[model samples]
Target: MKKIHHAEASSYFIEAKDNEAFHDQRLWDLRQKRDREAAVIPEFQELRNLASQIKEHTLTHLAEYLEQFEAKAQANGVTVHWALDAAEHNRIVYDLLTDHSVRTLVKSKSMLTEECELRPFLERRGIEVIETDLGERIQQLDNEPPSHIVVPAVHKLRGDVAKVFARTLDTDPDNDDPNYLSEQMRVKTRHFFVDAEAGMTGGNFAVAETGGVVVCTNEGNADLSANVPPLFIASVGIEKLVPRLDDLAVFIRLLSRSALGSPITQYTSHFRAPRKSGEMHIILVDNGRSERLGMEEFWYSLKCIRCGACMNTCPVYRRSGGLSYGAVYSGPIGIILNPTHDMRKYSSLPFASTLNGSCTHVCPVKINIHEQIYGWRRVLAKHNQLPFVKKAAMKVAGKILSDPQKYRKTIDVADAAIEHLPRFLLYSRMNAWGRQREVPAPPDQTFHAWYLKNREGKQ
Candidate 1:
């Protein structure tokens, strides 16, 4: 049986108390850093506006741009392949690897691979996949999907990493020093870069004018992934495409500042063709992107550049932890993206927010994230995807609030219960709100009663 998102988030919140606090503070720190970085750029808002327009223009003319990209890539001596969905994307990757007779494949962090479930698909067919990105490697060894996109293992402490390394890499579990752990991982995986028969990377931006796949990484691992092996492949989502190389200026300015509070990524590699003697292939994957584009309320989501800014600023995401979303994408972005992929599995997500609008404010591409989340709730209710208990409760609450006399009567009854009822019954399993939060002490008197008392004399 699938546990609903509310249950999953509640369990994480209750059990990971230490991690929960750290996660909240740490992400808030990132949010602060983002604000500081944004403050320095005099044209920050202007860049965001330009980026949103560029994306909207590209998406509206997506077909023409994609065709232009494919043609340019082909002209640049690159083999271009298209996949309509995840299964096809996986198959295309598997065949390409098998064709090159690759046994051990070294890959950098590619959410596209995770979205396509490519690692397991290849492993089942006797391919050994090595994750070259440190965070990705940690999650891989632990047998978990990445918790956060930019920082995949952000939920874990250095101590947790020491334990994971001890179990897998035979390092000292007690020595949780960051430098020692990083060096240990580096020394252990260095050979995979040289020995692997092939390498793969995810594209951050695909330029249609030059037909180049641009990847941004802080670690420089993506560069090694693309250049080291004789056989190279880049898995790029179609939405990552921009019309011209110059248009990259706007996104390049905003991407890191919004994501990690850095001026720019350490490595912004552009790959147009294979190396002198090596071969290269690019997989342009739709994977439901085209269908999502047709959705009027949600099509703006495609403008996302995977910055994770909204995630950092989101109070619910910071407190609940990214894994609570139980999907490839998490946080505000996930809340909107997951439902379109699977309504039944992710219907609880839209309701996970406070509709705070903080996410919309922080978005580099200006996506109306909170409004979209609210829109999803309406969509879910219409489609009967909301859970039975919630549907019934909303119905009752609607009735009570619609008529003023009934509302006042219910409020009086609730005030009496909170004031006089036993603690056990007041906070029993039946009270969902009380489960995660303390119900405030009953007011000295109902506001309505106080208003009647004071305002009666004034009138």
Candidate 2:
């Protein structure tokens, strides 16, 4: 597939003014909710700082903790698997299902599985992989990717959801009621719970000290998926591991409040091992995380807890929509992560941000997201990865900026053009900034000119 840059994709998103405004309002509501929730916690900033410190300590000593977790989990009868990359992770999961003769699998919300493209991977081989989470199931039925990590269908309206349900599951065509749709999905999802032979979930936190995979969900889908099936599998990023149960406590306090504006998620389940007779497996995926770790300036990106708070508060993300980034993850965090995961395909992501730093301010782990994005821009420029047009523009700009005479002459010409040219000419497609917005009115005179006139004789 040919890849389009964020700018081009977002242009299409911007065309939907109503949808864009609605999307912006919805995400901003979540941000406001987060702020309200945070206000009640007297030690919120302290909690975030503690979480950051714990993550840093754990990541630096990650290998030791992984070894410890593996040993403890096995002792608790939970089988552990390590995957060096996405292919390995998918293959490991497929092999497990095949070995157990599992023809049908039920899954909860798992961004890692989405990242690995697990549903299509298993489905291609005749395994009936079902997404049980309401938003995920809706997207799965519609054959679309998640628009937001926490709220998967935030880009969609209730009518769009009703239409999808009506078409795919044969629900009432006229009813767009939220409760009606949710009930229909609930009744339909229960069938997957009963028929599926295996279940899979994504980990919110992996407690290395106790070898438990913690999953937080509002819908209780993760619990249902894990308990009803005879086989359970969890796919977790390497970054999800924490040093101890106490560290997990710190994150648990921040995750839901930041992501959903709740004190805590409704169901925070911990799976250490399978029930009496069932089997449990944990697949720890690297998927370029180790490589990302080696980038000293950007290693802190791994501390993210997938809370999605940064996206909620991001001005650019609010307007652009998640699909604009063209990656599994989106928003300020995605701008840093996607390029680090694969720079060739995602090199345009860093340019998606406005560098307002609101993302960094709202991050539960304090990842310095905006700064990392700025750093990635330098990396891209260093490797000549920038577009030819942008490079040429920068070179010309640099030349003009280096000489005062050239700068003054250019400013004078621009001022004259702005003052004399017709709007149609000045705001045409040739002028990139003017294409989206009206050209700024020309200043009465250049700042330099005014300064020279007003201050030259002051002494």
Candidate 3:
């Protein structure tokens, strides 16, 4: 597959300015709410600092903690599995379903599963996998990937959702009412909950001390999926492990407040062991995370709680939308992490950001996201992964910037081009940056010229 550059893909999003503004407003609203919540807590920054320290400690002793967690979980009768990559993760889940003769499986919102493409992997093997989360289910039915990590359907308007329901669920065609649509989905999801032979959830955090997987959700889908079925599987990233159960107090305090501006999610459920007469499994997936740990400068990206406050605060993410990044993870963190995972595949991601550093300030874990993105740009350039057009532009810019006389002459020419050139000539297909944005005309005279003409005379 030809990878779409961030600029090219984001052009489609930019063309729909109205939709982009709507999306931007919604996310900014969440950002404002988060600010409100932070204002009330005198210890908010202290909590963030403590949480960062706990994550740092946990990651530093990750191997030891993982082994201890496995031992404890095994003692509690929860089978533990480790996957080195996405393929292994998918195979393990499929093997478990086949062994149990599971025809249907219900799953809560799991970005890890999406990362592994587990749904299609199982479906191709003749297993029915139903998404239990309301947002996830909507995307599943629409046969599309999520646009946002938290609000998966954020790109869709209410009318768009209503039309989807009308076509898929046979609901009233004109009914765009939120309460009615939710009730309709509620009525249908209950049936899937009962019929599923197995259920799966993604853990927000794994408590190493208690052999517990903690899941937080607003819709209670994670709890329903885990409890209704006889067999339960929790797919967790290796980075999700916290050393102690008491640490949940710090994490839980920041999670919803940062992500949705709520005091807490509606459900904060912890699974310590298998239910009586039921089977439980935990799959620990590394999938490049172990390698990421060794990267000194970039390793802190693992501290992310996935609250998505960075995305909410990112100017590029708000304007361009998540789909433009062309990766499972998006925004500032995605720009850094995606390239770290596979630079050849996602080299363009680092260029997607404006390097404003807003993401670092809003991060609950204090990932230096913008700085990492800047670092990735250098890495990509060293490897000669930069696009031909960008390299040419940079080469010319470098030469002009290095010479004062050349710079002034170039500026004069640019001002002339802006004033005398036709709009089509300046904003044509050749100009990637100008394709979706207006190129402001430079001032008619240079600052140096004005300084000599006016400032010197005034003096």
Q: TM-scores for all candidates?
A: 0.94, 0.95, 0.92
Pick the winner on TM-score between candidates 2 and 3: 2
- Residue 118 in model 2: lDDT: 88
Worst 10 residues of 1 by lDDT: 420-429
Task: Identify the leading candidate in terms of TM-score.
Answer: 2
What is candidate 3's TM-score against the reference?
Answer: 0.92
lDDT of 2 by residue, 1-459 (tens): 344498888988889888788899999999999999999999999999999999999899999999888888999999999999889999999999999999999999999998999899999999998898888888898999998899888888888899999999999878999999999999988988999999999999898889999999999999989999999999999889998898889999999999989999999999998899999999999998999888899999999999999999999998999988888999998899888767878888888888999999999999999999999999999988887767776787677669888767666555554644333233223467556677667767767778888998896
Off by over 4 Å in 1: 1-3, 412-430, 435-438, 441-459
Model 1, residue 360: distance off in Å is: 1.1
In order, what is each prediction's RMSD in angstroms?
Answer: 2.7, 2.5, 2.9
Clashes of each: 0, 0, 0
Instruction: Give the Å shift of residue 348 in candidate 1.
Output: 0.8
Q: Lowest-lDDT window of 10 residues in candidate 2?
A: 420-429
lDDT by candidate, in order shown: 0.89, 0.89, 0.87
lDDT of 1 by residue, 5-79 (tens): 665665756488888888888889998999999999899999999999999999999999999999999999999
Candidate 1 collision pairs: none
